[model samples]
Target: MTRTRTALLCAAALLATTLQTTTATTAAARHEQRCADTSDTRRGEARRVMDIVREAHRDLGLKAALVRVTTDGREVVTGAVGESMAGVPAGTDMHFRIGSVGIAYMGTVLLQLVDEQRVGLDDPVSRWLPDLPHGDEITLRMLGSSTSGLHDYVTDPDFLAQLDAAPFRQWTPRELVAFPLRHPLWYQPGTNWSYSHANFVLLGLALEKITGTPLERLLDERVMDPLDLRETRNSFTPQIPQPVLHAYDDERGTYEESTFWNPSWTTAPGAVLTGDICDLARSARAIGAGELLSRRSYRVQLDPGTVGLPGPTDTCPADVCLPQTEEFHFGVGVIVVNGWVVQNPSFSGFAAVQAYLPSERLAIAVSTTVDQDGASGNTAQRIAERIADALAPEQPLGG
Candidate 1:
């Protein structure tokens, strides 16, 4: 071929290469746009779920946030509605204490120690914590299952009053444990099931005693780090950040601001590091996948504790109850309701619901800054049910 003809052929090759590069770039952009569209669709679905709850519930005066993440590596959706209070700013990214839901995290830590053979779930409390009057009768399993006969300290008016009066006061686990220690047993250990935060408080102290490390450190090293949860941290001081939302007690005739309180005293018992809806949904999904515990330890968690509450609703089977579990009825630390296990409502500035269908690998998390009442639980249930229904349209809500 002549020089001019060869040069023309080279130009053709260069033009084809450029066209291919442009085609690939366009295809990449389209893929990203499609992913964004899917994310927005899921986010919109989540927002609509929250709207249904907001419009339907009148009493809660609720400000709600929700996040649903599917196992297909999709955040799907996250959005907030309502105000932190009647006249306050609209609630968004505000930290709400996850209340007893934190217990499940504590339960995970306890099981981690059990996995190491450092502690036995059924070992008598007397084996490690010998200071209590009835330590011999109580076992670590009972503590996790709420069958230890330990009274909940939150119900003690005097004790609560003391904490309320000095809500920011730094309290040691021993100081917090004293209240339950003063109360007599509700029954012999391993017999009855009750919702007692004190059991986990004792578990936290036991963790400290056995490991010579604070509960917060264990949480960071074991759970938080592995999960890559940045916002979650144990706070036992008044130095908690300022952007936190304040809560209210609507039980009174007039709605009163419950005040901007610190969680210094409730650490381990109720003090969990707080995070956004997305983070919580991720945590819920991780826990449901049994990524945090061994298979045998996971079995221990699912072993139901006892049946203490009113049986399942008429809409569901009789065996299905809240905090659903198998062995002791409590199912480790979570409640089994309608065969669906769940953690209690967090009572701090907000209430939290984290529920997942293990078979489906679908999880929903609802967090709200709202007043407590039937309304609070009802709203959460409705929103959670909607997400679950969307994911599992065949499964009916509880009767």
Candidate 2:
């Protein structure tokens, strides 16, 4: 997931624990089965990518990390470093929370519906959620592109305090959006751009209402199933399915287990998910190529800025808004960085980046964890950029 404003402020406010030895062994076996592949012909490239992962794991003091890359959706390279637990080595099969990547999935589903005439990107949300504030003015396109101007609940001080006080508390969608609804919009709907968890939450509600199907089912049918992302699934409780990568962080003074921390506050009920590195790599390619979307829908999803109406006030800040440029811009559920489509999510001691260079048909996915105090939250993204630079030096992964 893209970093929330509160996550940036509370960078040091995030750790892991001992698990049964049997559990570790089981996880290792399952990981091997899920990640096994023999088609890798780019040994030299794989070694180069592993060097980046190993160096990052040591230099950044990460508890564990994994990277997977594919060229032209055929030649594959995967690597891992450190441990999932105390003695359990990290593997490509181990699952970890993939925060904002879910947003990209939701956006893809919305565009698919648009292509099918099941929904319209410009349709006011009032058509689905009539009681929501300014629902009539906000459109699906605005929500998908984070241009709805809705206040980001994650930036609310009270919400941050509550989250720190009870890291394991499960939050409902209504409760999460209520924090933002209590405050006035940051700017008029469809006017300014700011990354808001509330926007995606509302998008989930609208999608459910429009299709009369659960969000999880809709994602499975529309995205996961078609792409064959077997490792991806929704989480209702704090539980991450087995073969897990234990995450550790020292944000709370002592390094402690944060692998199972409640993520219900992160996104919609069925969209919060954990997956293996392979799935992340696959998703990068599928989303970047927009294989399931029509040409028109793909174009809009890649550049929704065309529909974004600027507000009278300049509320665009460096943290929330990256000024539009030839090399950088926010797309529907995705970020374009130096012409490469990317999505990076960070939360609760886990950070990950999935980047795809459509020109080269290359996909790079990296997931990381921190164990040191005051560590930067963008560790995984930084590592992914290093690997991309090595593989696709012609197209630098720009800020």
Candidate 3:
């Protein structure tokens, strides 16, 4: 199977097998709390946008969903639906696991280091992670842009099996990278592009080694604190902080809570995080605007493809190394599609999307969780795409 398909299948299988069952009444209660006290502040199209979020959650059978949209960094509209847990109502302030959104933060920090001249994008990773396969040849740019050719351990059958066996197991970065490192490089470094969690894990480690600071602290100093994202913080344990937007799934044939499932396997220790929709919307603006980067650094962060990187090699076929198009291209840590810069991350029961339109200074952030029978996928991203269409009719997020 292709890597993306394999990863999705593993996630689906994981949702199916990981937890105990919940009663039908409890599941019903969770879904029934849709839009308990949804609030909106946008003018002209407030009700229209709020209706879209509410309808999408109900139609998609999401257990809980939160959405926030901002214009020029000012909150335009915000809404929440469904219960945080069986009987508790979800709110705009509820925190939920954000999955790979942390990848963007990693990329931003790397570019900040580049701006400071502490690290060079083209410098070999061997300078920090000398033991990695072909470490001497791989560059920081390759890791951040996902052109490093490292296998994604999340796609490894053995790793998936182990994860299924122990959903809450705390995985060290070494243990996670070992799975891909055990395999061969898909292609020579910078010769192709493929999304791999291993690349970010290594980049996180290298960042720590170079700065002598924890990844969480670096993120705070560079991105989170400066952006005033007080709600966003690393999750060192399985627990989602209080006022949690609990997630439920029927992947195992019965509705069950997967709210506190460990996410150590998702990314580096300090990179895995949970936050409310407000911070997500703010993050969309800050990261998208390159607010923390130099002009040259921001240019690289958004368009690393122009750095003369080679196309796909024979080993890295077209399916794995997708071609860049006007509507879609992978930038350093962001995905640019149809003039919108975006990041969407999905895990067991949670999914989130953050999208920014630079031309209009528009930002949309959505977080969602599936009901018992709802499909485990990118529900939030689809919802955000709809919202984007309504807000920016002239330039749809989809091409």
TM-score of every model?
0.76, 0.89, 0.87
- Cand. 1 TM to true fold: 0.76
Models sorted by lDDT, best on top: 2, 3, 1
Better of 1 and 2 by lDDT: 2
lDDT (tens digit, per residue) of candidate 1 on 104-152: 7777888888999998888888867888768899888888877787777
- Which 10-residue span in candidate 3 carries the lowest summed lDDT? 28-37
Clashing pairs in 2: 1-100, 1-345, 15-249, 15-256, 15-257, 15-258, 16-256, 16-257
Look at candidate 3 and give me any clashing residue pairs: 16-251, 34-82, 35-81
Report the candidate with higher lDDT, 1 versus 3. Answer: 3
Global lDDT for candidate 3? 0.83
Better of 2 and 3 by lDDT: 2
Provide the lDDT at 79 for model 2: 79
TM-score of 2: 0.89
lDDT of 3 by residue, 1-399 (tens): 699999999998877665323343453344334212244456666677788888987898888889888888666777788877778878886788887778999999999899889989999999998888799889999999998888889889999888877777899998999899888888878777788999888888989998999999998888889987777899899988756888775544467787887899888879998987888988999888889999898888888973344446677765566666656778888888887889998886889999999999999999998877775578999888888889898878764
In the range 226-343, model 2's lDDT, one tens digit per residue, is 9889889998888887778888766566778899889999988789988889899989999998888999988888898633444335555556643455577678899888879889
275 Cα displacement, candidate 1 (Å): 1.8
